[model samples]
Target: MKNLQPIISVESDAKMSKCRTLIMLISPTLVLAIIPIFLSFIIKKLILMTFLIFFGFSSLAMSASDIYFFIVILLKMRNNELFYQEDNKIYILKK
Candidate 1:
């Protein structure tokens, strides 16, 4: 008699890992916050340092969980990555 069994394999590529790392860093809130700062610098010549200080302080005031998520989104966006859902599975794609 011969034994028959199912073989399962997992393959992770650097590209996928990078995408995940990016997604973990850039959260939605961070993107929204950053947009205003960008506009302020573009339209009013406000100093970036000042905007950064204010952004940091405001983010710090949020709950730990919210802050974490916000940072995750920001990092992802900075890296030109985004997350999508398909068939209930989450996927990170590069832009």
Candidate 2:
């Protein structure tokens, strides 16, 4: 008799490792925070500093929303990659 077996694999986007994806997703907010701090060094005017601070803080809402949608998109794409065959091994698809 001969033994037959299939190989299994997990698939994901090569460019989007979990850490990198999450970090890249959230970096906009981080950049928003950084801008205000940088401004304090170059901008001596307190009024303008205060305005930029508010603008940065307000922009976080938009960035947070974008991140949420991106996470949803990633999850959907990942779910789509989960393909299986009725064999001894499974294969995953990556983008």
List the RMSD of every prediction in angstroms: 15.1, 15.0
**CA shift at 54, candidate 2, in angstroms?**
1.8
lDDT of 2 by residue, 1-95 (tens): 45543243333434444445556556766687657656756887989888877777776665765478457656754633533324444344564
Distance from true location, Cα of 37 in model 2, Å: 6.7
| Residue-level lDDT tens digits of model 1 in 4-83 | 32243223343334446444445434564655555555655457657765775565444355456556655554456655
User: Each candidate's TM vs. the true structure?
Assistant: 0.27, 0.43
Give RMSD (Å) of candidate 1 vs. truth: 15.1
**Which number leads on lDDT?**
2
Error of 2 at 71 (Å): 7.8
Q: Ten-residue segment with the worst summed lDDT in candidate 1? A: 5-14
